[model samples]
Target: MPLRSLLRTIPIEPSPEGEKGGLQRRMGTIPLMMLGIGATVGTGVFFVMHEAVPAAGPATVLAFLLAALAAGLSALCYAEMASAVPASGSTYTYAYATLGELAAVIVAACLLLEYGVSTAAVAVGWSGYLNLLLDNTVGVSFPAILSANPWDSTPGILNLPAVLLVLLCALLLIRGVSESAKVNTAMVVIKVAVLVLFGAVAFTGFQADNFADFAPFGAAGVTAAAGTIFFTFIGLDAVSTAGGEAKDPRRSLPRAILGALAVVTALYLFVAVAAIGSQPWQAFSDPEQQSVGLAVIIENITGAAWPGTLLALGAVISIFSVTLVVMYGQTRVLYSMGRDGLVPGFFARVNQRTGTPVNTTIVVAVAVGLLAAFVPLGGLWDLVSIGTLVAFIVVAVSVLVLRRKRPDLPRGFRVPFGPVIPVLSIITCLVVLSGLGLVTYAWFGAWVGAALLYYALWGRKSAARARARD
Candidate 1:
């Protein structure tokens, strides 16, 4: 037998109770779609436009399209895996069943940075907008000392709101506060409506000059900007992760994943196009316009505050919920790793009181909160792109491996073109990975190195390997 197959011989099966933990299967197709939108449409749509537009100029629309294409391909692969192996472990569990224990460990490590750090980044970004909303609408603002990060361009002592928000979400999750399918469907509707409103209002100020100097740095710039813009597309996998709770795993999972992808991509492209036409792309870099780029265009177009205020208010509400869902995903991924004995068992301990993993939630919440409080979102964005790039690459490869190893395994959703699709998916992910900056690679290396060292010295050696051997 192959060495990889030998590793699989060990039966480190999960305890049936923890396996069937009361985490209800209440998420259906509609709720799953909402979760995807909730997790995805937050900081990326509201905040990333300012950063991405200047890089790609009016071609920001094309950048959104390209990112969605790549994300769509990956999402299709994810749908197949999720339906084939319905579970809560996300990509880590999928990798374990199809690959081996070692590959699962590496994928889990990638996810730690992908989901955990992204949670910190989104929460921190949300804090900035929340502050903006308070100052403009409520006439209340926290001092710079408490509202900004100490390490920011204009340093503040701490970011109090960001920290508090993380804690709030943690408390909610511990009580098993899940968004019902109906509620999720409603949120998706609200999110779509708000973005459409922003696009319509912003389009009234459309100007032709913004297209001048399109692709300022040529294709390289578009690719680089896409790397940044890719964060907007991260939660497309929100479709796959809901497989266990989906109504018709085969039909609904694929349609929901593809439908959400199509809708989000169209909306994002519309926003990008509308924003570019509303102003000179260079104006995107103006600091005053960064927080509410679309809103600023509305203010300029209609010469009114109501539209801007409304957009900002929508952002504050929607982004808060996005932070909650994404942070919840991060905690659950860690919980799965902990349960597998690849990390501290403390992370897997479910609270008897609420029947949720309270301690783990707190640990993840505090760490992410501190990062959000002290580090600016700019510092966190590149790392999020890199971590996600690596994880997606792994999933793409896993799809191909599973096809060859277990051809008879039933897959509810299969990628078209067989090996060709998986191969293209892997290549596309790597191409995007290459576009990432040197600093992103450095940060990614440090994170992966840390996880591997922990695994080598502790997790791999002291993990359930010992239990399985005995």
Candidate 2:
């Protein structure tokens, strides 16, 4: 295929008129937003505070704000695109409609990392909390060799709990979306309640002195912490992935996207303030305190084991939901690509009885499960942040391109300030992207290069045939 043909754009349909193979519209705004919250709250709140606090001290609160600002801007762009496109591929579908096939392929690559690796990362975090829960409740824990990744700080043979969590989520996803959504909603409530409880209890030990040496490592540290914390906000885009399955895409897409972002940001801020106030920021760095940071704080405050056990139980339960939501997003995106012939058709084969992409879910399950079992959480999280930031930048830029190229297209939601919002969104994502080190960029580049190579060698031919058939 010629370069121009390969870059050809997919038509922007006003509705699902010509989209014959689309998923069923079964989700409403509440479930959609719950999916986002389920995806967003788990890993970051439970695991990342330890990493961020050590980087920025009490100024980690500022880091949460900075990360939220960046995520919010990108989410605004996402809301617009989700409402307009209303497809399963999320940014990939948006890019295909606006930017072109090549840009869409690139966005798909970024999403593969964002959703797949993040699922693995979340599972790894879940493993830690599961161990914490078991230790507190049963007076026993998984052997280090079975519970920790080989490359983690506490090296082990494999992370068995992480792998088990991924398999369990895959089973639930294969059962169907509505069932998954119901489970996710319940998990969201549990996690949010525990976070609020932590805040209330932590407030009892609040100390103004914790803020006295805020930003001890200065501006650089704050930026670095924001970069680290950015992964927590990654699941906000999961709302857009459900557009095809949304009961009313036009209303539900924007409402769910923005609503999820607002709820997550508020909860994150509350947790951050309460956490730093409850204990000195410097203590977050102690290797012994890193794995179950929030529970430790609760233990310190109440001088009892029960409160810490409650938080650990919540973490174990809620993080499982996070893994399920993220893995679902990953499979749905792959299903879109498969339908478009960018990947093998196996992914597009939905189970008729359940109306779910069973094959795709299984594929994602095996791939993410392996990563969770072997890869270190720190590296997986950094890669997720880089992939997500780049994907957000592309989505923001696509909004500008779509407005200029096809202004007549009906949009359910539009960014309030036109180019200004998207431009700022792009800039904010770039700033966060810059904080990542050279190694992360190299890994991201290698992944993208491999994806493009596959596109050139296989996807191009398959996509051409698929388009010709349509």
Q: Which numbered prediction scores highest in lDDT against the true structure?
A: 2
Q: Best candidate, TM-score-wise?
A: 2
Q: Per-residue lDDT tens digits of candidate 2, residues 254-309?
A: 99999999999999889999999988888999887786668888888888878768
Those runs of model 1 whose alpha carbons end farther than 4 Å from true positions after fitting are 1-18, 47-59, 153-155, 180-187, 203-228, 242-252, 276-291, 351-355, 375-377, 465-470
Give the backbone clash total of model 1: 0
Q: What is the lDDT of residue 189 in candidate 1?
A: 78
Per-residue lDDT tens digits for candidate 1, residues 365-467, read 8888888898766766677777677778777887887788778876678899877877787898888767678987887778778877777678865565645
The superposed Cα distance between candidate 1 and the true structure at residue 95, in angstroms, equals 1.7
**RMSD of each candidate?**
3.8, 2.6
